[model samples]
Target chain A: MHRRIVSLWFPRLASDRILRINPVEAPFAVTHHEKNMERLYCLNSQAVQQGLVQGMGLSDARALCPDLRTGPANLHADHHFLSALLRWADRYCPWVGFDGNDSLLLDVTGSTHLLGGEEEMLEDIHQRLTHSRLHVRSGLAGTRGAAWAISRYSKGIVPQDKLKIALSPLPVAALRLDDATCTALQRLGLRTIGELMAMPRATISRRFSLDVVRRMDQALGDQSEQIEPEAPKISYAARITFPDPIGLYGDVIAGLERLLNRICNKLKRQESGARALRLICQRVDQAAVQAELRLARPMREAECILPLFERSVRELDAGYGIDQLRLEAFDVEPLPLVQVDANTAHQDSGDALDDLITRLGSRIGLDNIIRFLPAESHVPERAFVEASAAYTSPESKWPRNQGSQRPLRLFSPEPINATSRIPPRKFCWRRMHFSLVKATGPERIAPEWWLDDPSWRSGVRDYWHIETKQGRRLWMFYTPRHPAWFVQGEFA
Target chain B: MAELEQFFPLEIGRAHEVCGAGASAFAAMACGADRSDNARTILWLQLDWQSDIVNPVGMTPFCDPSRIILARAKNQQMLLSCAEEALRSGAVSHVITELYRPLDLTAGRRLQLAAEMGKATGILIVSEGMGSNAAQTRWQCSPECPTSVSDGHNPKTAGLTVLHWELIKNKKGTLGSWKVCWNAQAHRIIVVSEACQ
Candidate 1:
């Protein structure tokens, strides 16, 4: 069987897209900044008829037509629209790919009969796109290269046996060569593809590049070119469609229960679980209501997942009635099966802890529930790090600190109104006065010189564990360079 | 000392309150005293507005910081709900919460019921003096200065932290007062002397 390929070209994609949204009668052009000048990127049919070609400066284009409307070119939006068109083209055939910025290539081999024939498919696509106010030119042939060249230079279909004759009349620029290469080939009296092919292959490869010969062979069906088809996304979704729309809350819960059972059973078979899930309720009035859930751990049990959705489902308004309920599970992870024995049953506390974390996270977020992990630093504030309990497992052993005793509660250093190198006789803090009874020796701790810590800008500190007469033990540090005392923590 | 050993491990499945200057340290010691083989985790809840945070480096002297899970709540309602949920799960051996305002009798009763249902201990660290609540016991803790002694050259007190705890309210035991210090090397609390009334 012969392979059939189709090429589609959009002559004025940028200008047509803008005009489609807001129709204009005057000539319009899209301009982009290049070489420190605003040059025309694409033009509408009205602008083309006024003799304003692409790459012309905006000033020059204004001189040609006084009523020319101009807008900046948006390449990103054009590419996004082209991809949407690719998905729309999937109805014609499954093997659709992007050819260039302004064209699409579809391989309709063995499937053209379903659309009546090759000629009928092309005509149907042209009529539909034209009715939608889009200008599209299409060509069908046996090879991709031949189809591409025929679409831009000429119009019609090329049979499999006469591929060479159909592509011969097209200009040498249609062979997908650079402007410099095409100009050089034209200088040698080769203006058409037929003339270039009549020359000796060895002579052409020597004078020009080997790309010329390879392109010729590909267009003639002598060299094979493959088309890469876009893979469809895999969806883990289950839906229940009702004959009659249900508006009761109990009915919605019943429908959701059935959907969860089906989805959980499917996940159990694959030894996988979901960490994020989305529930979409399609209403009969053409409106959709969605609720999303995030779990701390991957779970597949129907009973465990059902309660998490209860609060969200109760809040959803089943406007008019809901005809369909769809459940989608994403962020999947592999969850191995564990057997339930006496020893394992006793260790179910871990599962209960995970459930508790998930419930709390639903209210206060998982980041607020934290566990402390020992950090490798000697600084009092940097000695430990906080990690979310949902993500990090608890460490079995914590490295013991062999330095001076640390305070029970730590605070960002608050300066006190005392200026004594030794413990003061009395000091005021938080509107209270405390008289020192006995104090320990100063433990000098130098700042880490490698790091530029703003908090440690006061240079080296001399720490003292002071006992006050008011039954309060405070950890105070004095900076010798700054000549100040600051209370950093409490021994509560 | 023998009678103190019986008090070392506070009765499980009950709710207690510790207030005053040394409440946090006393509650940390109580949480560390649970050396059971089955329950290994401890849940600690506090308000997000509290400026002072528990330092893991300092907590190492009482309990292993790795065994503690800290939860910060936005309001008092969230704090109490989190404490009740954690205590009712039975996954943790103890649930310790720091309360800025005193807990009412109804909320205290709910917490006590949760602890009983899960067979877990609940400890509340109140900032001010105790109020009317359904707690099993109430303790008032304060820091006490150690006695200074002169050896030969320099005169210094023994470098151990001393605290005085008074049992202000007890439903099942006698009210008493004792001065105790934490022994870091042995990882236990030792009674220094009975307070002179």
Candidate 2:
């Protein structure tokens, strides 16, 4: 079947609504109300038939019709609304392009097969637009320019070779020519395309202009016109509409398995893996929910992504049963196939650890599960640290140690008041009697005054590595002369 | 504006100043660091008391002062559980702890020697009444005014946590008690919120 193309146009569309407030069947013509007003003001033709006319100041138009609603144009909103139609048009055809502010050109080449046939496709697209509460004019033709002209002039299809006859009755303006060219052609009594086509091209150019001939040549396909169509921003989308809307956990689980497989298949075929997935659910009353799942690593596996969705489905607001499901993957990148062990098919040990962490993380949250990384610090108390399970590994080492003997345990030094200078005989702490046994010298380690380190607030430390009578080895230190002993740490 | 959660409000406690030789090494542990100087390390230590502990749950959270009594001075101290805990909290800016008996000879030398090599802040909570010679500060708390009464709620206590706290001995600050709020969920002292009594 030959593909059909359609172009739409709205002439006096703004004029019919602006100066003359007749919303429909309003015959109007719009000229510049202000000198610099670009495309502003429309003439009310229906109102003109009822004694309303253009160049009659807007105030007079309002005086002629008391209920006439007058308003300025919103050019930006118009463009935005038109762009939205451009996106919605994607559902019908792959090659929908913007024609103008009030028009859309659909290349319904292969798309007619989807909606049954050519007339049906037009009716379907028309019905969709009508349901959206918009007024539109459509025309189909074998040529782009002919379709545009016929849509505005005749509101029907202009078959191939019938272009000259179809565009004949329309005004010279239907040629989409500039005002100067149209006025020039009108002055020469060459007011129609057919009239102009029959005459010598040299005479038309020689009398009026040369650029009109170029436009005229291109419209007739004598010269090739290349259109730089914008392709959709290459997104990843997979969707499934359910025959029966199911709400059970088992049903959603089975559906998710199939859905994830399909999505992963698409990503794999595209040579990419999904970094993020959005699950969209359509339900009762046209209400819908879109749940997004983010991955720490880009992934493409039914085993990997499905389980994540299963747990995540509980968080989705299904609201009156989901009838349609869609999954879109984004932030995709090429993934290498994981070549694995053939000798022991069960020996994928690298993933075992990550799986355990992923499960634990899914429960208490990934942030709460952490592992310690050793730190490089000379301070005994600052030698170790913990990192979240997601960003770091459990067995990573922090560069520390390489100094003096660090106590496995460092305590707040409790002072033992010396009753005598001969390093006390016995002191009671926690009501437990610790008798002094084998003693060591007072290692008078002064605070490093040059560095101004704060932990050394006391003048100096006379540390003693002593052993208690109970055989519990102790490391005590004293600030002697102004003599007071402190229990700092223990030796294993 | 944010009302700090009745628990840890994403605000990890930070050490004001770290010293000893290896102070810089342990400096990274300050709750979070100023963005400009980002190299920081925090070591959190959780010491489960085997009893004989006064305010075992670090009332001042992390501060300690000491002097040697004549008898225990000849020998030293060892803190088994606390040292293990500090090595655990890698992101804790301050090495805060509480101990039943002051760290003796072996313990003090180990910690001082440890601080000398790295930048770490160790705040040990020592009982106010027990006078030892090793700790830097002996923190003690006496009951202040009875907790206020509101409607049917008891003024002296709220839920299971103690609310009113007073600072007894601080080696670096003006020697007096400052009020401390408490959180039961986090089991830590909440810093004061009001201007003054």
Candidate 3:
């Protein structure tokens, strides 16, 4: 099979993209900062005709063309436009790839016949792009390198028999060599492709790099070059349209059930589960109403997922009636198939727990549901960390600390009025007076110096387990240096 | 029956209430005592407005902190709904909730029915006074001065403080009160003194 590659180059993509939206007739140039200097990145045809070339400093360009209008170059926007063009070029060839930021390479092998032969296909592509006001220069040849060289330096088709004669007049830079290598070749008087071709292959390989010889061989069809085509994105969405608009809740649920079955079956085949799903309900006389569902864990079962959407779907106003329903499964994760025995069918409690968490999270947020994990810190406040139950896996065991006693309920430290430091015979907390019946004291703990904890700025603390006459067991601490006391927790 | 006499046997598939200052401590002890080899998960729920949180380090003396799942609800309605949902799932062994206000009879009955349906225990730690509800047991827990040390300031018994548990209401058994303390080495509550009514 003969491989015919097409190269399409957009010479002024950045400048033309701006001009297409806000049409400017005067000479305009797009400038970008490079090496701490503003250089002309792309030039419009009007600016080029006024003797302003790309890479010229903005100051020099203004001197050359006094009426030159300048705008900042948005390379990101230009790249996105070029990608959209690549997808648009899919109509001419199935295999199309990006060549640099400004060009595209399409291998239209045997499919060009569908658009009435190779010449007609090129003409069609040129007319369509020009209709969209994009400056496109295209070349078709037997090899990718030859097509690329002809597209930038020359335009038109290159015959297979006259490939050498066709690329001979082009400069050595046409072979995609580095600036230094091209300068070196030009210094030795090897300026054109024909002159470099006449040199001995051994000397060229020894003196220059292997790239020079490889590029020449690839252009002349001796070495094969492959173009990486972009693959189409696969969307995991299913949609169903009813012949007549259905408004009842039961009818809508029936339609949702069918859609869920279709999407779940697709997920099962790929061994993937949906973590987040979106449902779009298209109405007859109004715009679409949408609802979203988030799962605690990746799930693919239709039965388990259908119920989670029931409340949200019921709340969605059907307006006049819903004529179409679309279900899309995003945030997909790989969930390998698990083999279950018939004897253990009723013993899968993990799924039930996850389902419950998902239901509760949809109402009260998943962040509110948490589990405790032990932290390696002596500071009482930093001793434990909370992890979301919906996201984190359950730990098997917690590391046991056989240290000093800790309070059952911990709260922000509240200052209490006490007369003396020794467990205060009488103190007031939360506007309530309590007299201490028994007191255990003075387990001194120092703050971690490395951490500038605001609560620990009171210096070292001496803790006490004090029981009150009113049957209140409180965890009290007194700062020796600050001479103050605070009630921080309760044994309850 | 004799083996269960030493410890308060919280009936499975039923609702219970604990009030007063040491309710949370009593709930933790009950959860630890009822935990078996298969039953591990305990769901603990609290209101969002409440500033106090359960310290994992403190809970380690009674229950394994890793076996607990904590949730905070915005209001009482959400808390009760979440408790009922967790109980009805049958995924956890026990569901413990901290109620700011007293639970009504209807809400308590709903929780009881859900617990019975799922075969899980439900424990409510109420802050306010208890109302008439369908709970199987109601307890009042308070702290008691340590009697082991005469001076009440001995360093040896510094970490050992006793709690007084008064079983004020019981449908299945007689009312009683006992002074108990957590034995860390045995991982169980031991009775220091007992009083029957």
Candidate 4:
């Protein structure tokens, strides 16, 4: 396959990333604070129109235009947004990589033909990017270095044979050299790349840095340069664009079934199962509705997934008509077939349990569903912790009642009014007085000092398993320092 | 034993309502009726009643509190729809819903049909009044003794909570009223006295 590399440079990425999230029409600049001084890190078109240059001190930039608005530069968010753009560019080619922090490199050698000729492919990219309101400069060449320089220096594609001529008019900065190197070359009267190339190779290597010669050689294709493509993502998506706008709910369900079947087929081929599936219905009016189903176990069967959507399908409001339907599965796991005899009617109860989990998870929310897991702690509240069933599993069997019995029901500590802490012969709780019929010794428990628990701020607790005369088994605790008694739990 | 089985058993694929002021007591009883040896997940659909959480320790004797899921709906319509959706989900073996007011026949029928379709049991715990609907059985329960003294051998143990219930409507059998108690040792409901025929 012929190497057809395309490079896209995002000049206003820092500011564009911010504006894309928060769109404001006023003149704004992303500022950076350095050494107790603030300076402009990036400027939008509005700021640029007001003759504001980047790297200028904040005070000076404000002087140029008194109404200048400033925002703190977020390099992290900018890099994240650029990575998303790189993934978006995968539609054009599989081999896509970040050129720098703000640019992308795509190897569309065999892929460009899929979208008509190379010229039409570039036009498609340009048009779509412009539609998204992102300002981009692009170039295509035979080498990564040439493509990088052409994108920053010149416009459009450069033929492999005409690489030297195309790069000659560009300045030394086009080779992506450091500022000090560019200035040193400029002082030596090597202003244009053409002048640098005319000089003897040995002379250029000795006077300027070896990097200058290497960058020139790489750009001219004398030495090959390779790009590190972005890591390929495992995508499980099945999409269908309608021939005509479908308005009916039945029609939408039909579309969903088709997509779901496709996804299940794909998953079956890979010997994997999906834990979560998302359905996106794009309407004719441009409003899209999404319905997501989370599974308790990895599932690949269409019958299992289709019914889960049945309850949530009504919420998918196909405003006007849904013209496109897409189903994407996430968190896929290997689901090897479990060997079982045909005659044995032992259907995996796991499947039934999973169905229950999925149904309850979707309706009541997966977070609300909980499972009790024995935590490695001695404290009563910390002895067992409730975990979201969708995420965690019970690791250990609950410790049995050996010497002492624990309450079946526990509540957040409620203060009890008791006759001055003498094992509470009588206590007033919830506006009702209870006489202690039987009492167990104080089970002293110390707080985990290493961990800061607001509830355990009282230091140590002496717990008692007491039965009230009213037939209520009460688990009460007394604090030594506070000399107070409180009811923490009750037996069933 | 035969009479206890006949007492408003929470049959799968059927819709039942436990009405009157003591809805929570009957609701807890319905949850205890889950017959699966392996505990099935439970979803509590909260509509009008705000506080339905049992004493955490108290739940241990009845059902695994860890398997309980709590969901709150905005209005009566949403609550009914949510209940219908939960019944149709077939996710849980049983769904215990709290209804502040009686549902109309249409809404109740929809819920019943959904329960049948999903192959799960629906237990509606309604507060006060008896609005007629399509449920297979309607029960009226109230706390009777709350702490009735069992055989005085274990006086230290808190007294058993006794409930009086009347099977006001039973589509499959004759109506009856009986007294039942929470057997702390068995973690289940046991009929203490004979039913009044």
Candidate 5:
């Protein structure tokens, strides 16, 4: 089947979203600050009409149009708007992707005629977008390259038979070449697509970059170019519709339990388990309440999931009864089959740990649970890194007997007021006074210069493990840079 | 969430609940309880806005800080329910929770039952507030001054820390106080000062 691709260009997508929210009739442009200079990123139609162009300095634009309004360039908001438009465009075709910065590519090959032929589809899209106050230009062709070139430079649909004839008159820049290459072609007098095409292929490749020749060939349809369309995510969802709405919590739980069983069985058959699950309680009034659970490890067992669901299910207000219950299992992964060895103690313990993680994860979140892995560093705090307990395993045993001794717990560095003595006979911390019974040498630990730790801003430190008269074994550090002492850690 | 009832039959059970005095005291007890061999893994669940102040580095005195699973719930309801779930799983060795306020008697009973059913221990760290609950034990812990003798490395003694703990309520035993220190060499909580009634 012949492919039918549609390309839509949003010349002022970034500026347009802002203009849409606050309608502006005067000339306006989006400016991006780069290298200490504000440059015009994108311009609206009014700004373009006033002779302002993209990449022109903001100062020059303002000089040209005294009443020109400008806003900071928001690429994020533009991309977000494009994604929203992408969902809306799903009405046209399921396969739609944003091409480059300000364009959308749709593969409507076999789907266009369903919405009353190509012309009707284009007209519908144009009218809907125009109704929404979006300035859009669209082109439909047999190939992505042809469609893209036509959308930006020409108008309407270009049929397969006339693809080459229609592109012949356009400038060489229509091939999306860089300005240097376009200028080189212009200097060589090969200004139009027809002129570039008439030249020898080997000569064109030798004169310009391979990309230049490749793009020209792609535009002319000599070589096929594919458009990457966004793939819709597959949702593993199961729902039970009730003929009569059930009001009781038990009835809702029953329906949910039934739906869960079906989905879990399906997941088990697929050899997969869901890390995240969502229960959508569809009320009789059409309002839906959702309860979600996240697991540390992927789980498919009904025994493991249902009990957790029960608590969340009770939280949902059925409100005027519930007509349906839908359950979705997302973030699915293959649950590997483990060989049940005779050494069941070790295996069972591992499984038990995983189970504990999942249950705890469903409640507290997996990120908060962490495992410490020994890091190769002399700095006391940098000696270890936190890894998610559910995900990472320690690679090697912790380096024992590293410095004089690593403390059991490191505090967030509390400063201590101490006597300015070589051994500092007494010290005060947390409003409590401790007379030093005995003192150890300053174990000099230089700060890791590569790291910018806020606490380490004082430079190198002389750490001293001191025993206070209060019977406390304290790990304190004396920074020579600022000549101050800090009570950093407490043994246990 | 899709329920997978066809996979395994749902079991009904609850967990054991115990309350601790404060954050530091709770941390000490949790560290001590976790030292027991029964726990397969430890879950440290903190309620909303309660980022764990327990330095993992300092946790070297208790157990492998890496082995402790930390979970932060967004609210009190989530914190309670999550704690209950962790206890009921029967998978973890211990469940430690930090809450802004204590659970009521009913919720405490539910947690206790869950822990019993799961064969796991649950420790609830109540900050500032207290409630009448069905916990097996209620403990109050406070930091005690350290007393140590030097080992000739320097004139200073380096490795001794102590906490004074009061067993405020005991379901089976008499309420008492004791001074304990973490012995890093043995990785155990040794009672330095014997229990005083």
Candidate 6:
């Protein structure tokens, strides 16, 4: 049974063309991106002939060949281009995935028959990408890693099992050990995969690392090597265009309505609600700026989203004008289909209504809005946390003991200015004076000693509930370390 | 839990007599505290934006109480997002946005009525100078808690909070300035007792 696998390696893809630009014919190397002002990852036999040697930096490379052209790598663009090739490669094999960052791997088991044979299928994939200005190497073997090693190390028309032999002579770098590991291996004088294979099992296991053994097993098909494909992100967005670019900020509001309607319609179909919205304004000079809105609830409705865009109009840079308007639902949460009773649903709860929230969320980033989360701790300060507008589901209770009314705000522990060491009569704190009338609690809260965190360096805290003659109730605390008293909270 | 939400009815006394001519500032004041002391107790909530935050309502349904608490941010769009967060906290009387510049009168009226009907208080926290334009009461405030004090050796950091509020304008007799100690952990503020001092 033939397995049709296609592999493409764009080693000199960057340098091959620079040779044509200025005609620096002899040994000039093509360099990848620059690390700094000087160095370049040189592609040399092609480079050295043109006075471009192995150790030259980009500036040095450029100086080596005065008229040499340089190209910056575009990884995202490359991925897009790679995806397009994958689409085209479907004619040869059904399973195709990327390998080693710059190569494509395909499994053509049971597919080669349609393409005439293994050779023809390989030829077909190679011809297609090459026709589209991409270079590839074809290798066929029983295993994925073996094929990979053969493609990287072996010569043209590598027959089956030729790789098992060829791989032995190839450097350990072919096993994909990172630079540091490969350099370490080279320093250890175990340069080739053959040397690594020859090393004692105990020594390689104890000295080198597990990765070396894992790579060997994968190459020999003793272990499975799986390629994780990137999952396509869930994106919900729609756009509209006008005959003439709309310049007025008010004009965009109407368009936003249309886009919002479309977004809501799509979300409704999916039984989902949007937590965030991004308004992309495509302007002149190919410029685009996105205005976003975050919702506190999983919401879907034009009324909820429209008013938000109304507020955002003031922030938009309505340059030469917006030729295209796009509204994308950025963060999404599954909207559980709700059975809205006609009575409660239709009953107008208030004159202002809930539209204000949607309006506001879409205007600012979703995260900017936050709600308080009740935490598990009783340390007044640790009792609650600030939550994002859409991260949680609604709960029924404040989730706390209903004994005392909590102050609407809590201050970090502050010094309590008092005349005496004990709970004093009156004290000055921050230019103000106060006297305590009622008091409770010296609840000693010790820092958890198990987890040593620096912030808890002050050993323990003793809390007190104190009321002042002026009718202000306070949750004051005294640190035992220096025996200092300070006010921390006030009862509402 | 539902009882707690209703515990604070988004309502103030006087049987729904709306405050001054439907301004955002007026509506916020009309829904002010109803204590007999005539001191409209106010809570100043400050937040830090450094980490991941959960949705308030999701954590507790009480946060979605009827009170409409509007929030003001650096920009108009930011107002909505902030209000949604306040709404989830369960105790805001109404959400009122005080913008840097005056908006259309209809929008202000819409905001005021929306705030009142929800039994929530709407607050327009405009720039200190801007609120003066439409506010029934303008407050010139200093920290209620003194942060630190000067020690004989170094300027010792004062740990207590003390805020002084002066009512620059009001429909009733001018309320004298007040000095209150803030207790953050308990989320309460206390009126300092001069006699104890």
Which number leads on TM-score?
1
lDDT of 6 by residue, A1-492 (tens): 433344556555444434434555455454455555544443535455576654467776776677655455445655666665556556666677777555667776677779787777667766775665444676676567777777777634444455457678988887867899899889999999989889887888788789889988877667777654444445699999888888887789889888888889889988999877889999975899778776656678788567655666668888888899988888898997877686775333321233433444454444444545456655555665655534543233455434343443355566765524467778766566677665666677787677575645777877777766554556677776776777765443
Model 6, residue B22: C-alpha shift (Å)? 26
TM-score (chain A only) of candidate 2: 0.48
The reply for model 2, stretches above 4 Å from the true place, is A1-5, A9-97, A106-135, A179-190, A198-210, A226-235, A238-255, A280-290, A307-326, A330-492, B1-197
Model 6: TM-score for chain B: 0.43
Cα lDDT listed for each candidate: 0.86, 0.52, 0.86, 0.77, 0.73, 0.55
Q: How large a fraction of the reference contact set does each model reproduce?
A: 0.67, 0.00, 0.75, 0.23, 0.49, 0.04
Candidate 2, true inter-chain contacts retained:
0.00
Model 4 chain A worst lDDT run, 10 consecutive residues: A393-402
Among all candidates shown, the one with the greatest DockQ: 1
lDDT of 3 by residue, B1-197 (tens): 12235337478888899988889998898888874654668899998878899998889888888889899999989999999998988888889998877789899999999999988889998864764468888888888754433434444334566788888777776777886677766767766556444
Residue-by-residue lDDT tens digits, candidate 3, A1-492: 889999999998998899889989999999999978999999889998999888999999999989999999988998999888989988888899999999999999898899988889889999988887889899899999999999989988887788899999999998988899999999999999999999999999999889999999998899999999988755689999999998898988888889989989989998999998999999998699998888989999999899998888889999999999999998798999988889887657777888888888877887899988888787777888899987887664655756677899999999887636688888889888888887777788899999998999989989898888877889999998888889889985
**Candidate 4 lDDT, A1-492, residue by residue in tens:** 558899999898888877877888989899999868999998899999999998899999989999998899888888989988998999999889887788999998889789997889989999998888788999998888888888898878887688788889999898889999999999988999999899999988887779999999988888888878977766899899998988786887888899989999989888899999998888898888899999987899998789888878877777778889989997798888766787655445446656766776777566655666666777777776666676675443555445565665456888887636567777788887788766777899899998999999997989997766664567889899877888887654
Task: List the candidate 6 regions with Cα displacement exceeding 4 Å.
Answer: A13-39, A42-93, A109-128, A139-244, A248-274, A298-307, A326-358, A362-365, A394-408, A435-443, A448-459, B1-111, B116-197
**Model 5 stretches with alpha carbons more than 4 Å out:** A1-233, A237-247, A254-272, A280-288, A320-330, A333-365, A394-396, A401-409, A423-428, A468-470, B1-39, B44-62, B71-85, B95-114, B122-197
Candidate 1, residue A222: how far the Cα is off, in Å: 5.9
Give all TM-scores, in the order shown.
0.82, 0.41, 0.79, 0.68, 0.64, 0.61
Candidate 3: residue pairs that collide: none
Model 3: CAPRI class? medium
Q: How accurate is candidate 2 locally (lDDT)?
A: 0.52
Instruction: For each of the candidates, give the backbone clash count.
Output: 0, 108, 0, 9, 32, 64
Pairs of residues clashing in candidate 4: A356-B91, A408-B57, A409-B56, A409-B57, A409-B58, A410-B57, A471-B158, A471-B159, A472-B158
Error of 3 at B186 (Å): 4.3
Which DockQ value does candidate 6 get? 0.08
Prediction 3 TM-score vs. true? 0.79
lDDT over C-alpha atoms for residue B35 of model 4: 64
